[model samples]
Target: MPQNKAAIATQDAPAAIGPYSQAVRSGDLLFTSGQVGFDPASGALVSGGVEAEARQVLKNLAAVVGAAGLQMTDVVKTTVFLADMNDFAAVNAIYAEAFAGAEVMPARSTVQVARLPRDARVEIEAVARFA
Candidate 1:
């Protein structure tokens, strides 16, 4: 196995607001930090409600995953946090489509939270593996 390590950064996706990269690739595994609805280029929240923000979050995650040299299909696990359970069905609708119609889905857990950083309605983090 290769011992060299590297980080992935992409202009297509939102940049890390804090002290973190978009994604880190190590030994065939990629870990993406929790992504919110903020647009990295503009550094502002995507203009819309829950559905729109959720879509942006998913898109951002996709970009980070791609930066790690992987696709949504490569995602092995995910954890989704939402501000409200009422948005479950609505969020699921968009979340399902974000996976690009893949048949094999990753293990996932969704939960309602009291709040999140930046007051985002949703946030997502993922783990992927590459050969």
Candidate 2:
């Protein structure tokens, strides 16, 4: 951790499974690490399907963003990663619903990846500005 940036953590979100912080705040921006569908309490990926996973992923991101004293509406950009491109529609719907309250929807990029940690259906990361 450098003096310019501080790592963010929250019990409301699942702990990082690797050598990374849940998020890091530097200057006016907060950058959240990618979050999957795992529940913080159970430490297990939520059941259902891509939609369920997408919802959980947003919840996890909200927790991380909130930990830094920001809200979903503050998010400026987001990157969504999916294990399968076929799940895009389902995840997109969930993603839209999660940030529906935002005055200006965050810019976004979604991509399909070969695999994800814990085999999650979807993962998301965000950049938010609180200052």
Candidate 3:
């Protein structure tokens, strides 16, 4: 049987710069593309350090998830890519605060990558489930 899939998009998040959807919904799950620290209105990475960029990344992810008719609390997993491992603590702090009130924090994996799109300090992607 063929699966039904739909692309999710929102003006609140920066548009994809390449040939990829912002997020794709397959059945009950929504898989979002990795979101860099680009500001939707400006189409540029947010100015500042890792912490600031991480904040914007989360906001972008939130916008994608929200467009799929889900909330941040619905996220079940996440993968974070960072340009530097040294920024882990700062990004972790921001990540924790971003999902503070959730009933259960999503499982996450964070790793240092050699580089990221637009030289962003951070990028984040999420998987959310809907009942």
Per-residue lDDT tens digits for candidate 1, residues 39-123, read 8779788888889999999999998898777889988898999999898898889988987656678889999999988788999
Model 1: how large is the Cα RMSD against the reference?
A: 2.1
- Prediction 1 global C-alpha lDDT: 0.86
lDDT of 3 at 15: 99
Which lDDT tens digits does candidate 3 get at residues 1-131? Answer: 88699999999999999999999999899999999999999998898889889999999999999998899999999999999999999999999988997999999998899999989989999999997
Give the distance in Å from residue 77's predicted Cα in candidate 2 to where it truly belongs. 0.6
| Candidate 3, superposed: residue stretches over 4 Å from native | none
What is the Cα root-mean-square deviation between model 3 and the actual structure? 0.8
Q: Write the per-residue lDDT of candidate 2 for residues 26-47, one digit (tens) a residue.
A: 9999999999999999999999
Q: TM-score for model 1?
A: 0.89
Model 2 poorest ten-residue lDDT run = 48-57
Off by over 4 Å in 1: 1-5
Distance from true location, Cα of 84 in model 1, Å: 1.2
Using lDDT, rank the candidates from best to worst. 3, 2, 1
How many clashing residue pairs appear in each of the predictions shown?
Answer: 1, 0, 0
Q: All models: lDDT? A: 0.86, 0.93, 0.94
TM-score, candidate 3, is: 0.97
lDDT, candidate 3, at 25: 98
TM-score of each: 0.89, 0.96, 0.97
